[model samples]
Target: MWRCPLGLLLLLLLTGHVALGAQKGRGRRELAPGLHLRGIRDAGGRYCQEQDLCCRGRADDCALPYLGTICYCDLFCNRTVSDCCPDFWDFCLGVPPPFPPIQGCMHGGRIYPVLGTYWDNCNRWWQAGNHSAFWGMTLDEGIRYRLGTIRPSSSVMNMHEIYTVLNPGEVLPTAFEASEKWPNLIHEPLDQGNCAGSWAFSTAAVASDRVSIHSLGHMTPILSPQNLLSCNTHHQQGCRGGRLDGAWWFLRRRGVVSDHCYPFSGRERDKAGPAPPCMMHSRATGRGKRQATARCPNGHVNNNNIYQVTPAYRLGSNDTEIMKELMENGPVQALMEVHEDFFLYKGGIYSHTPVNLGRPERYRRHGTHSVKITGWGEETRPDGRKLKYWTAANSWGPAWGERGHFRIVRGVNECDIESFVLGVWGRVGMEDMGHH
Candidate 1:
């Protein structure tokens, strides 16, 4: 004889009704767990149920045909391994379904089933099973690769502190750009290729601009990040990754030649391979100066003159102070957290989206990266909301994001870009101007 547990019997007694099938099927039917009837609605226009649908005496034979599958109304269906019909909660337990309706997400005039994802350029758009829309890298092969910029150690973060005090009643402009203020002086963005050496790229970029602006445009040389990548090897991993403080230290102590001299050699397919041999070398020329020992790597250009910078200084986290430093001086270096979605950045004042908030840990990956903050501005949205942003130059080449530049939300330290800002002075001399 079939026996029902006391607990299940108590549940059956409380329900007061059980609608058993008229005929007992030959064999038990199996259905996928959590299956629900789609396009089927009730009196309340809900998809799960129409009227009372229960079972008689914990019967496993009690089933309803739904969308070519069978769903159970039996009391046993509500066990730890539940395989109850979607309407079981409403008709049997007087409660709503525990999960949302199984529905496809509508996007771009097409319906995507739960968890469907597709990539458009660098951006990945996904629709979760709950019908929620999100934009980020999916759990695909691309997520395996990490971005550049290692998080600064405490020793690196504490080096070279320099503060800028705001003058009393000296109001700053609503917008500013180093390129506009110092036309033809600021270096255009350079491509880092597959190298993860943003530390070198950003340092060289800032130093190049500062040197040009400090020298009054008489010597507007594009300083070489490749020079740093190949030669600055003391406790540093070339191309793989390195610290910004160490990069600046190398710039101050060893110095580097122009891009025309060393030239960038990072290949698009060789990110993990060993960096090329340090082609150019230099010797100290006495009294805190040095000169290149070898010819330019490009061979056509002979200008192998070494450029240097003063000790890089850390700026306060204040946005106004950062703006003042950028306006009064040149482009400043800043470290930012590059979330997976950042790779998809096309335009507009970028703020890290919360679309990936409830995702798995693997899908929420990020890495540290450095950029040059050129200027800032504010924009009023069509809905009257004000958005402030900092214009920055990325080393990913001109093909990406506003022609090698991007504007991210400022003031609130979006992605921690304002946290570890830095500035430096070009160690320029009369001899540097004579070369021009």
Candidate 2:
């Protein structure tokens, strides 16, 4: 008679699979307590299905007596012990095993588990087939959360067509940086955190540099991105995402306060929450000018003056035009498609690598992002190949690539960065620079 031990019966009852023989199927017959024999196609030797063994409970009889030791087909067998049958996953779970028989990965002369990951310098190295170990989230999540610049609208695109032609005879230098050329004028890059507000951050950074340069370092004020994020509501989705044209439009019309006055508050809000209310407002001060109508959000600094920018102009895709614009006028904003691998950028002339292209479409995501193109240069490689690159400032903070800056392949419109370049003039009158 088929009889289960008291301990085995208690375990089966706890697992809620006590009625073992009740399941009538392909020649199912109880062999010993929880152990049952079910007819399966004869592949070769006795496997999980051949023994009619697919255990759901934690019982001693949930295993089949195999060569010398027992092999378990129970659900919890592989939790602490690795004594699962060869066909346990296939027969019991109707799915393939987590990995092939050859487990663990080989890297740097050491064997790592299937999902092992490590950091080499700034870049993260992960075992093959372990995508989540690198970025903590999937590519889709990165695109949705990390980036924010939306594709330019038709009007913004048409603006690029109306490029400000520069003098072709102007002899440009091999390399130049706005910070080096105009020290203390260009503001360092600011961290946007996880909020997808690069639109506001980039615009604020470019405007800050331009204003400082235009005023001859007299009004070197770091503008507030939070002012743009909360205030620029016209066709703008503050933290979630926004367009460059809308950002520039807000800068030209509504204007923003200095970082000391308004400051950035996007980091404080929930990642997916609505933008905070506009803390600072302005009123027309005659002759196309604006004055702050409210006190500084930060009470310490009594200066609540509004800073405005003239209508932004577009630069040609030609590297020379961009260089000239950046050299003459402070920093310029460039829109680029940020791919998955960009988040891993450390320091180098960055180019979208095809390493992750073989991944599924969901893992190879890209999103639009705006950055401040500060300068450009060329470097001769060991192979005598001269590679040109654009020195741009990202809004991911100082800890990121090259102390808040990065270099990308300059020519060939790499990543479409050179496709749409924009420059703006700060509306700094004599009175605006009177303090210095």
Report the Cα RMSD per candidate. 14.2, 14.8
Best prediction by TM-score: 2
Best by lDDT: 2
- Compared with the true structure, all predictions reach lDDT values of 0.69, 0.70
TM-score of each: 0.68, 0.70
Q: Which ten contiguous residues of candidate 1 have the minimum total lDDT?
A: 127-136
lDDT of 2 by residue, 166-213 (tens): 566768898899889999898899988777899999999999999899
Worst 10 residues of 2 by lDDT: 35-44
Question: For residues 182-269, what per-residue lDDT tens digits would candidate 1 score against the true structure?
Answer: 9999989998866778888999999999999999998898999899989999878877778888899999998899998888986553
Clashes of 1: 0
Error of 1 at 356 (Å): 1.8
